[model samples]
Target: MPKAIYAIWWDPNLGPFLGRSYPENDPLTSEEAVVIFMGHGLQQEAKVGYTKLAKGLVVSYLDSPNCIAVLLDENDDPSVVERNLLRLVGRINFNSSKWDAEITRAFLLLQELIAETSGQELLSNPHVTRLVEDMATGRVSALVPRHVLRATAKYPKASDYLGPDEEEVSRLLKDLERAGHLVPKTYGRRVECRQCGGTEVTLELACPSCGSNDIYKVYLVFCPKCGNRTQTVLVDDLTEVRCQQCKQPAKVSELSVIDVELLCKGCGQATNDPKIVLSCANCGKHMTNTDLLGGTGLAYYPA
Candidate 1:
C-alpha cells in the first residue's frame, strides 16, 4: 500500500505557504502542532502515494479512505491543482458561507476520484458506494479531529497514499479543518478558533476564472453554462495576464484583457483577481473587502 502522512496549519491567510508553517520554519514539527482543529483558516487535503508498480492500482480508493487529510500535497503543480480545485468548486460552489459536509464530501470524492483511470465507471464499486453512504449517513469526515484516536486499529494501516507512523490519520483531519475545507463537528463539544477564540472567519471568494469579485459590475462574457470565462484565467501560468475577450472561443494564449468580472469559489461572488476580492465565510460568495465596509463600520476601499 502507498504510505501517507498528514499535517495541518491554521491561520487567517492560507494563500501564503501551503504546507510550511507560516512565520516559522519549514517542515513543521508535530510538537508545535495544535491539539484541536478549527473551523477557520485554509484547509489542505493531500494524499501522496505510489502503487509499487507491481500492485497494478488495486481497489478504487477504499471505502471512506478513513479520516484522511483534508488538504494534501505541495508540489509545484499549481496549474493542475488550481484548475482541478476551481473546477470542482465551480460545480458545487453557490457563492455563500463556508462549505458544509455535503460540499466537503463532494470535493473529497472528487479529489480522490479524479486521479483514477476510469472515474465515472468506478462509481459502481462497493468502496465508492460505501463512501457515498457514509456521507449520507452523516458519519463523513473531511478533516480529522485534533484529538483523534489512531485509525490504525480499525484500518490497521495507512491507506495506499501515506506512509508509516509519520503523522496519525487524526492529524490529517486537523489539517483539513484548518485549511477551511472541512467542517469539524464532534459530540459533546464545540469547535472554536485556535487564534482569537472567534469562530467567525472571512474567506475571499472570486471568479475561479478571472480570480475577481466584481461580479455585479463586469459584463460576464461567458455563457455561464461552461468554463469559457474560466479558461481565460489560466491563459498564461508563466506570467502576468490580461483577459481574452475574444468575440468567439479562442486559445487562452490568444485572449486579451477586456472588461469583465470573474467568480471565485472561496466566496460565491464574481470577482477578478487583479482587483480586490474578499471571501465571506458568512455567505460563500465573492465580494470586495469594501462590501463588508458598507454596513455602519470601518469603511475601506477596494485595493
Candidate 2:
C-alpha cells in the first residue's frame, strides 16, 4: 500500500470538488488543485487510466457514475497504485450511485483501504484478490450484477484462480451469502454426479421402499375393518374409491386418508414417502438428496 499525500472526489458534471492534503496543510483553496488535475485527467477521455506525475510522483484515477476520484501518493509503482484504485472502484460500485450521501461513504472506504491494516489482509484472500485484479484488468464490469459471479466462474482459468474445486467455490459463495455480500435467488434443485461432479444428473421420483421409478400420484385410503392402508381405485364413474388391498369401499375422509404415498409398480408395496433420487448420466450412480450439492442462483458484489 502507498501513503496517499492527497485525495480528491469530483462531480464531473458540476465542477465542484472535495479534497484533502494529508500530514501537512496546503495553502491552496480546499479543492483548487484537485479540480485542476481532475479536469486534466478528463481531457484524456479515458474512463479510468493513470498518467505520470512529475518525477517520482504518482496519481491514481477512478471513474464512477458522473463522478471521478484521483489520488496522489508518493509511490511510483503503477501496478500497486492501480490495484488500490481498482479496489476503491469495487467499493463505490457495490454501494450503487455515487452522488448524494454515498460520496462521503465512498471516500471513507477509499481511505480505509489505503490506510487500514485489515485492508492489506483482505487482499490475501484468493477470491478478493482475483476480483480486484479482474476489475483492474477490465475483465469484469464495474457494476457487478448478482449473476455475473457464477458466470465468471465458468470462464476458463477462473476456477483455478478462485477455488481448488467447484464444490469449494460453491462453499465460498455460501459463505459470502451468509455475510450479506450476495443477493440470493431461488433455482430448481440441481444434482451433480457424486463420482465425477458432472451436472448431467436426472431427477426422478422413485419408490421409497422398492426404489422403483414407475410410480404415479394417487390418493391413499385407509380401511377400518381390515386395518389396511392402500392406494384408491376409482370406481362408480370416479364418484367412489375402493381399497386396492381389501377391495372394499374406502370412503374419502380425513380419517380414511392415512397417508398419500408412492406405490411401487414392481413390488406392489405402498410407502407414504418417495425418494427424490438423482441418476447421474455419466457415472451411472444413484444419488439421494444428501449426496447432492445444492447451489443457489445469486449475484455477488463486494461489501
Candidate 3:
C-alpha cells in the first residue's frame, strides 16, 4: 500500500493549496508541495508518472489543469501504483466546495475496488472483527489518538478509542488496513525524550544568562521629549502615558514603547531571545531542540 496520498490544487494567484491528505495530518508541508508540483513538471499539462525522491517514490497525476494528486509509495511497480492512483482520482469531484467529504468518499470506493481486484479475504481476527463491527454499527467513526505524543512512544495506549490496550488495538488496526478495511492518516508530529524514550515533554523558555524559567514580559513607556522611561501603569479610559519624571501626560504615539523585552526575575537580565528547553515529565531530562527525537502521529479511519 502507498505510504500516503495527497490532493493538491493550484490557484492562478495563490500558487498551490493542499486540499487534503488521506491521513488528514500527513507531514507533507506546503513548501514541499510546491517543490513536488514544480519538480514533477505538473504546471504545464496533464501527466502521470513517478519520480524517485530521497525519501521514496512520488507518483503524481495531473488530473486537471489546476489540480494534481500524488501517491508517496516505495513500491517497485510504478505502473500498478499509477493505475491505482488513477482509480482514486477518477472518483473525486474537484469542483465541489466540500472537497474533503468528496475525497473521503472516493477513498472508501478505492479501497473497495482494490479489495475486489486483489481478491483480499475478509479479516477474521476476533479483535479486529469486533472493531469492524463497531464501525459498521456506528459505534465509532474513527480511531483517534489518545495523546499528543501518541506516535513517539508506545507506553501511552489509545484507551479512549477502544477498551483494549494500545498495542493490541494498534496491531488490530494494522491488520484491518492490510485487509483493505482501514486507512491510516498522518495527523502531526511529536517530540520524544532521548534519555528515557518518553513523549511527555514540556517546552519552557529559560533565561539565556542564568538558565532560569522565571522570565516575563515588561512594558516600558519612554518619553521621547525628556528621554525619561517608566513602567506603564493601568488607568481606566486612559489612552496616554504620564511621565513621572517629566510630569507631563503625552499621547502614547509621542512615547516609544519597549514591550518586546523579556525580563528574567532571577538575574534581572532582559533579552528578546530566550533559550528553548524541552523537559521530559517522565525522567526530568532537559534537552534542546536538536537533541529531541521526533516521530509522526497517525490516526486510523475506515476505508
Candidate 4:
C-alpha cells in the first residue's frame, strides 16, 4: 500500500550514493561501485518507476526496479503489474560502463538526479549525460524539466555508492520498490497507458473469434464426423468454414457477426461496417446500426 519503494545494492563503495546525495551530478565508477543485489516484492505495474542505474553501461539494469510507486487497489491484483513494470527496462545489445580516468564527477551527479525523477524525462534528454561514466547510474533527472538547470552531480568511484554488477543494483532497487521502502512521486499520464510505442498487448496473436490472447493463440478439438482435424486448408464455396476436428462444416451464411463493427487497422475507422439505413415511406425516419435492428417491419409491406 505504500506509494513508493526503493532498494540499493552498492558496489563495495558507491551504494550510499543512491539515497541522500553529496553534491551536483557526481557518481562512483564500475570498479568501486560494483556489488551484487538481492530482491524485494511488489504487486507490479499499478505503479510508477525509474532507475538511477540506466542503460549503456548499465544496459541490463532494467530487469527490476530501483524505485517504484504502486497503488493499493481494492482487489490487489499484482498479476500483470510485474511484467508491466519491466517494460521500462531496455533490451540491451552491448555494454557501456567500462571507462577510463578521464571520466568525471558528472556521472555521479546524474545517478543522484534520476533516483528522484520521472521515467519519461530521464530517457528523452541528451546533454544530461555528457561527462557521465556509466549509464548504469546517473542524472535521469536531467530530462525532468524541473531538474534540468540544477545539474545533478556525480561522485567518485572511491565512495561505497558504487556497484559491481549492474544487475545487482537492479535487484536491490526492485526489492525496495516491492517492499514499499522508497518514496516516489505521483504517477503521471504515461503510467496509465495500456500500450507504449510498439509494446502493445503482451500477447502477439489474439483469438479471432473471442479476442482472448492469453496462454496461446490457438486450440484443437475432436472432429465430430471424420475426426480428421488436420492442418489442411479446405476450399469450400468460398464462404463456409469447417472445423478440421469435428469435420463439421458450417456455412458462412449461418454465422452472424451481428451488432459489431470493424475498425480497419488500415483506415482506423468504423465506416466500412455494412450500414443499415432507413427512410420512412411516410415520415422519412432513416436509421442506422441499432435503429435498423429494432424495426418491427420492413418500411414497405404493401397491403
Best by lDDT: 3
Candidate 3: segments with Cα more than 4 A from true spot: 39-43, 53-55, 119-303
**What shift in Å separates residue 165 of candidate 1 from its native position after superposition?**
37
Model 2 pairs in collision: 146-299
Per-candidate TM vs. native?
0.17, 0.30, 0.35, 0.19
For candidate 2, give the lDDT of residue 266.
Answer: 85
lDDT of 1: 0.33
In terms of lDDT, model 3 sits at 0.61
> Could you tell which candidate, 2 or 3, scores higher by TM-score?
3
Assess candidate 2 and give its lDDT.
Answer: 0.49
* Alpha-carbon lDDT, every model: 0.33, 0.49, 0.61, 0.28
As a whole number from 0 to 100, the lDDT of residue 30 in candidate 2 is 36
Any runs in candidate 1 off by more than 4 Å, and if so which?
A: 1-32, 35-39, 42-114, 117-303
lDDT of 1 by residue, 133-245 (tens): 45446655332222211112111122222333323333332233333333544322222223222223354434555554444434333423343653344422534333354
> Which candidate do you rate higher for lDDT, 2 or 3?
3
Q: Best TM-score goes to which candidate? A: 3
- What would the per-residue lDDT of candidate 2 be over residues 164-275, giving only the tens digit for each residue? 5554454344444443444345543445444544455566888887778887556666676577777664324454566667777644543366556666788887676678
lDDT of 3 by residue, 202-279 (tens): 778889999998877656778766887876543457678777787777786676776566788899998878887777
